[model samples]
Structures are given as C-alpha cells and as structure tokens.
Target: MTSAPNDLAFLRRLRPLAARELRLALLAGAVAGVMVVLQAWWVATILDRALVGREPLAELVLPFVLLFGIVALRAASTFAAERLGFAAAMRVVPALRRALLGKLGRVGPSGAAALPTGEIVAALSDGVRAVEPFFSRYLPATAQAAMLPVGIFLVVAPLDWLSALVFLVTAPLIPLFMVLIGKGAEALNQRQWLRLQRMSGHFLDAVQGLASIKAFGAGPRMVAEVGATAERYRRDTMAVLRIAFLSSLTLEFFSTVAIAIIAVLIGFRLLWGELDYRAGLFILLLAPEFYGPLRMMGTAYHARMEALGAASRLVALDALPEPVLASGTARPAFGDGIAIRFEDVHLTYPDGRIALRGVTFAIEPGETVAFAGPSGAGKSSIQALLLGFVGPTSGRILIDGHPLETLDPEHWRRHLGFMPQRPKLFAASVRGNIAPGEADPDDSAILRAAERAGVAGVIADLPQGLDTAIGNGGRQLSGGQASRIALARLFCRDAPLALLDEPTAHLDDDSEAMIHAAITQLKGRRTLLVNAHRPASLALAHRIIRIEEGRIAVGQAEPAETACPC
Candidate 1:
C-alpha cells in the first residue's frame, strides 16, 4: 500500500538510528544486481562459444570458472544484504520500543489518558515488532526496485534496444498493478490490526476479571464473547492473506508475460538472422533478472502495509497528551521527613473534570495526617499532586519551604513510599514483590517488613513461603493478600515520606489491624499522608483533614482520644 505522508515521515525520523547499516545493505543489493548482469553475460558467452562456435571445452574453461565465481559472489552479496538489512531493523526496533515505553512512562500513575492496557501492550510488543520487516525487507527491496531494473535496461539497450524497450514499457505496470491490488489489501490490513488490538484488550480484561465472572457464573458468556473476537480477528487475517497472495500472483503474471514477450521476439529475430546468437541469448538471460527486484518488491509490499497499520497506532500513542514534567533544578532535603503545604492548589484533569478546587493545607515534618472524604472528594487528588503525577492547573505546593514545582520530580519521588488504593504487584516471587528492585534483599529485612504489614502469617502459610511466585497482578493471591503485600512493599522502602491512599481498603478486619499496627509504629519517624475512611484508621492520624466537594471542610488536629466525625 502507498503509505500516508505522516507514516512515511515517521519512518524517516527513525531511519537515522540505523543509517549506516541501511546504507551498507543498499550497497550490497546494488553489488548483487551488478553481479546478475555479469553472470548472465558470462553464461551467454560461454554457451555461444561452446555450442555455436564449436569451441573446445578447454577453450571455454576460463569463462566457465569466471561464471561460477560470479554466481558465488552474487550469493554472498545477497546474503550480506539480508544480514545488514536485519541488523538495521534490529537497531531500529529497540529504539522505537524505548521511545514508546518512555512515552508510556511519562503518562504516570494517573493512567495513559484512559488508554486500554491491552492496546498499550499491543503497541509496545506486537506493534514494535511489526515495524521490523519494513526496515529489513520492504525498504531495501523498494530501493533495489527503483534502480536495478533501470540499470539492467541500460546494459541491455546497447545489445538489443527492443528488449530494453520491453523492459522499460512493462516495468511501470508492476508497481501500477501492485498499488491497485495493494490499496484494497491496505484497508484489510488496517482493519486486521485494529481487530487484533481490540481482541487483545478484550482477552486481557476477561482474564483480569475472571474471578468476578466466575462468581457470577458468566464463564460461558465470557467464553463466547472472547471466541467471537478471536473469530473476527481470524477472518480479517485470512482476508489480508488472500490479498497478499493475489498481489503476488499479479506481479508474477506481469513479469512472466513481459519475459515471455522478450523471449518470443528474441527467438524470431534470431531465426530471421537479424540478431547475433550470443546477444539474443544474453538478452533472454537478463530478462528475468530485470524483473527480479520488482518481484521482490511485490513480495515485501505486504510488510510495508503491516508496518503502516502498526505505525499508525504507535504514532497516535506518541501523539497522546503527555504530562509536562517540571524542569526544576532544586532538590528538596527529605532527610528529616518532608514538610508539605498546598497553597490554594487546584487540579483539573484533561477531560475537564476538576478533582481539586481551592484546596489548602499544610503538614509538619514527621507528622501523621489523614485526609477524610468520601470517594471522589479530592482526597486522592491531593495525594496525586503530592506524588507529582500532574501539575496543578493553578496555584502552588511548597516542600520544605521550597515551591514543589521547583523541586525535581524524579529526585523528589526517590524518597517517597506510595501505596495506591488498588495496589499493583509484579509477577514475581513473594520476596521479590516485598522488596522490588532489590535482586537479593536480606530475608530478615523482608521478614521484618512483612511482619509490620501483617502478611508474615500469610507468607508462612504459603507452600513455598517467601519464594512463592505470584502470577501477573498477583493472580495467585486474593485481593486482601495482594493489598497486604503492597503494604509490605511500602514498609520495605522505608522512605521518609509515605503517601497511602486507602491503605486498609478491601481488607479484612484482621488484615486492617495488622496494617494499622504497622502505620502506628511508623508514625513520628516519617511524614505520613493517608486517605482513610474507617474511623479506626483515621484515629491513628495526629490531624484529620476533612474534604468535601474538592474543598477542605475542616483541617484540625484531633486528639487520638477524640472520635472523628465525618
């Protein structure tokens, strides 16, 4: 398919990453084309001398040896071209993956603008892989198609201008018809990619929520739904393949017909004694060679369509609104806990949903503060601002007497221990989950953290203790168990500033007590901000900040003995 201008431009932007390898591949392909001409000339000359001139085998020995060498060199050049093309594609794929992943990372914990998890996965894995063939095969073949046929015609024109005329006349038809057939295939390919992405998203969602489906006894319905998505994907894939086969057939038909026409003409002229036998045979040999690159181009054209379909998604992902990170040079000192103050902070999401409105509060260093609010009352919004996920639409936050906007986010985050309401666990051993990024954390340290989070008993009951592998998102564990594991991970971090969003959410009373004990022990050693709903959890705070409708209804220090009234 003819690529859209933006698709082509996107490809051009990535070309420089592997420019040297791509140039070498093109050089190798050109050498192979030159060898094809020389090989044909040698074969025609040897045949003419040995058969028509009745030359001795001994006299033709040098030419035979030279022809063999040409064939060997041609094969070697072709191999080099293939290897170099693959090398270029390999280099380009990693760079593209890195760029895509970095873009995703910048989206932060707030979510990738509501991008589907499956779509993100497909783009990073399947989409990036799809681009490989465009660089490796389609691009080099296109370059060869543009030059090789013309070079062959230049060589043949001197010997037989009619054959050169045939080559010139029929060459444009290959790409003309290729485009005609490819236009239909391009749409099919695009649809196929889109269907695949939807299918991936559906399947991922189904798997993640399998427990709910099972509880509702909707397994059969989910199965049917997933099957329908798979079937649609299969049909679209087959349709794309059908177009590919048709395009290949069209190319072969045109090239074969063109070669046949040249053959018939050369045979007739030779029989009429109007052409020399060697020249006639030479033109005949070069005819197929003239169409070879064009045929190769036709075969690699499907890869181009696939890459474009994938690239459209990738380019769109890159075009997604990314959070503009603060370019602050100042680094805040969090050694003795962090003093945070929000001075009339306001936060509005991209979708025009205001999460915070004129919210203002302050927390002293090493103080334990709790934000009490119903869901969507800007409690988590305050935590989001503190985490630097998104900058305030208007107003400022101060960190240790310094404007929060002036502190480097990456540096500021390094000292933070955050636990979101729906905590995520990696597919790793229980030990690994407790101490993420630590290759071989101290078992005693892991034990201490687990004990603090109250998951020590749960770990002991596991078949393999801390070495048990929790599947993706802790599928092997219950929600409460996973939440406790996340809490343990927070304790393991031991950062000076801890932000726990509903740390006791979705937990049993027993599990809640374990975590409460952990937080109580952690108090006065770090700056703590928690979004708490249960009265028992709010009681642990030295101060309770009540929020309602994005405004602070009350910000008062409540003695532990006093009950908090929401």
Candidate 2:
C-alpha cells in the first residue's frame, strides 16, 4: 500500500477511540479553562477592591475558595480522564492482537514464508505497544490543548478585544510549527521501527542457528552479524531521537515568540495609559496561560507521530485477509475410514513457483500409503495441500465425493492427526503436553498411547512418570525421546486419518524398528499417508507413491509386502 492510503486506513480504524477520547479530553480542557479564567478574574477583583479603598474580607475569601475549588476540580477531572482513556486504550489492544493473529493463521506458512519470525514478533509486541500513548495520553492532550486555547479566547473577549485578538492570531502558529517539524518525524519513526524489527529477526535467527554455527566454527561470524545489526539499529534510534529533539525545539521556539509578542503588546498598552493596570496585569498573566496547553501539545506531537508509525505496521498486518469459513456445511463424519483422491491437482506458490503439477492419486479407506521423493519434489507440498494449509492452484481434491474446500478445515482436521518432521513440544508436564487441555484421558489410555509410540518404557522409568516436566520444546529430552513423545501425542489424538511426515527420520535403528511395529499395528484400521525416504518407513507402507518434478510417476504397491524385523 502507498503511504497515504495506509495512513488514512490507520486513522479511520482509530476514529472511534479518537472521537471518544477527544470528548473526554475536551472536558479536561474545559476544567483547565475555568481554572485559568477564575484565577485571573479573582486576582483582578481583589486588586480592584484594594485600590478603591473598599475592604471586603468576605469577597477575598470567596476568590480564594473559588481558586482552591477550580484547582481541585481540574486535578480530579485530569485523573478521571487519564484513567478512563487508559482503560479504553487497553481494551483495543486485545482486539488488534486477535485480528493480527487471525490473519497470520489464514496466511499460514506459505504466506509467512518470506516474513521473518522475529520481525512478526516485534510488530506484535513493540508496534502494538506504541499505540498506548496515542490512545491514552497524546490524543487526549491534543484535544485538550486545542479546546483550551479557544476557551481562553472566549473568556478574554469580554474583557479586552485586543488581548483576545492577539491570543487568537498567535495560537495557530504553535500547531503550525508543530506539524511542520513533525512531518518528517513520522517517516523517521517508521524507519526506526523497521530497523528494530530487522535487528530482532537477525538476533532470533542467530540464536536458532547457534548450534550449527558452533559446529562449523562460524560462531565469530554469527557474533559479527549480530553486532552489525545492533549497530545499525542504534544508528537508526539516534537518528529518530535527533529528529524528535529538533521538532520539540522548533515548536518551543515558535510558542515562546508568540507568547513574547502578546506580553509586549499588553505591557505597551498599560504603559501608554490605554488600559488599566489591573487589566494589563491580568492579560499579561493570561497570555502565557493561554499558550501553555498549545506548547505542551506541540511537544507531545512527536509522541503521536511515533505511535502512528507503529500502529500503521500493525494495521497492515491486521488488514490482511482471514480464512473464510464454510457456509451451511455439516461436519464430515469419517467412521473408521477415509478415502482421499486428487484429480489433476496443481499448486503454484505465491512467488510463482509451481510446487505440484497435474498430480493424480487415490488412497483407499483403511490403507497405508507412503510418498517418497527427493527434496523439493512436492512431497511436503502435497501433504500441506491435503491438510488445507494451501489450496490447489487448479483441479480439486476430494474426500468421499465432497470437495475439500466445502469441508470446514477445523472439523476436517479433527479427524486427522499429523506428526511433522520436527514436532513442537510446549513447556509443561508430560501428561499436559500429551493430552493438551482438559480432555482427561484415563491413566490406562495415556500408558497405552505411549506404549504404541514406543515411549512407555522411557516415561515409566522417569521419577514422575507421565507427570514429568518437559522443558521448552522438549529440550530436556533426546531427539529420539522427543519424537516418541510426539508420536505418543498422535496416538492420544486418535484421529482416523493420520499424516506422518518422516516420523522416524532421526531415530536410531532400535527406535525406528519399535516405531515401525507400532505403525504396522495401526495400518488396516486407519487411513495413513506417510512422507518418508527411509527404508524402515517404506517397509510399513502397503503402497508407495514416487513423486518427481511435481508429478507422481508411480503410485502402485509391489506384488508382495516387504518383510520387517519383528
């Protein structure tokens, strides 16, 4: 999107909170204006009474009381406005986060392929966080500043037209200068945020690949890359700061000049006997008071720009299209069987790369099929399409004569279990990771799944059994153990259609053989699609599909089943 359109969309989205917050902010300005006018009028009244030789002690007491009341009321209104504004600001954050997350989910791995994980994290965290000031403080302050000046002009008009005119003419300069200075600040702020996201992405990449770097004796190179990214980020940050300071200085300079001009006019009028001493004093005092809020708003304008820059990125992410839900479709029921058929299917990546072409295949219910191919031969792509991660570019995939697109992805997935090459493990107890949420599988069921996955012995030997804590990503477990734990999770899921992607790729011969036995037991009862190149995995398949150049060449089983070690 072009910069102008992006900004308009962002502002439009924020209009609701902006309007609500502005109203509350104007209330604050009203209180501030009342306080200033009452203070000036009280002082003028007291001076007038004294000069006229009339002592009204009760009148003096009333001014003091009014002064105290205004101050207390202004303070209370400010506190309430801030509290309510902050609450409103916080309320929008979750909705924004959900919108962004939902978009990412629809985009999936293919859409996110080019986007770095760390950058997305930065946008989700720091970018969304920046909107807080815009919603809570800067936005309200801007409104209050704007209304306060106008209110002051109305109060002064009855007392002195010249003073009110001077005030009105000069007030516009403050915001004008603020906008002129802040024009470039928004662009600079955006650059700074982008640099920070790049730095975060680089750091996360370095950390994830640290093991490989150390193995290849490239640790120093990775460290140098990280250092370079950090330096670049620091430079961008300093650039933003420099622009912000200059903007603030320029706004302050203009406001000071305007206030100085007003003061000079009031002083000269009093000296030339054109105005009363008491009136001149009041105008002089009110001159600075009138510009105070504007000056504050000019200074806070940078904060608003910074917030806008950050919010723009978040808005972009949230605006991305989300997945469309199936309409008026009943949940598919796969009863101990599933048949998948791909008819002349084709898939092209977003970047125009074709991953699959004219692929045709079929899997019978209660049959085990394995896809074997070299890297980038469409094995993973086909699996992804089957799982609804990406739709086919042409042709169609069907399950039981129903088009895959017509089925609810979530409901379809519930009957399917997937174990990728690298399975994710959350930091939690073994049972919690195995069962996930509150679907309390009995102890026997848990043990049975673990046994089928060949991990029952390992869990049984642990001091806590199924209750043992698995560190983040199952870091505490060995590769084979982690794979077994993931398999155990799959068995616990017990979906009728299973998609196993190289489930035993990294395991030793003993573990692989044990898992093969488990697979043998699962066949002829559940529909299975295994993506594998290992011999042990191939031995378990009733049929093997060979993929090459985005097309399936052979999809029939051998005359006899390959024997496996008992």
Best by lDDT: 1
Candidate 1, after superposition: displacement of residue 282 in Å? 1.7
Q: How much is 435 displaced in model 2, in angstroms?
A: 2.3
Weakest lDDT window of 10 consecutive positions for candidate 1: 555-564
Each prediction's Cα RMSD?
A: 2.5, 3.2
On residues 1-566, what C-alpha lDDT tens digit does candidate 2 reach at each position? 22746754675586574466556656765676777777776677677676654777765787677767876876787677777667657766666677677678766666656466886888788887877777676766777786777777887788789878877787787788788878777787878888888888888988888889889999998889889988988988888788878867776777678778877887788779888877777777777778877877876777788777787677666654332222215477788879999999998886789999999988899989888878889999988886767788888888877788888777887788888998888998889877776466577878889998888988988879988988889987888888888888888888888999988887899878877787777788899899888877887788788889899875333411553221
Total clashing pairs for each candidate: 0, 0
**Model 1, which residues run further than 4 Å from truth?**
1-3, 326-332, 456-465, 475-481, 554-563
- How many residue pairs clash in model 2? 0
Error of 1 at 164 (Å): 1.4
Q: Summing lDDT over every window of 10 consecutive residues in candidate 2, give the lowest-scoring window.
A: 319-328
**Model 1: per-residue lDDT, tens digit, 1-566?**
22467876787789999999999999999999999989988998999998899999999888888889999999999999999999999999999999988776666657476677788889899999999999999989998898789888999998888998999899999998888988898788788888988999999999989899999999999999999999999999999999999999999999999999999999999999999999999899989988989999998988988888888888777776654444566875677588888889888997789998997888899999988889999998888777777778888888889887777777887789998888889988999998888866999989999988888999999989999998878988887788889988888888899999988888889878877887887799999998989988888888788888899885334654475556
lDDT of 1: 0.87
Q: Which residue segments of model 2 deviate by more than 4 Å?
A: 1-4, 14-36, 39-59, 276-282, 319-330, 437-444, 554-566
In model 1, the number of clashes is 0
TM-score: which candidate is best? 1
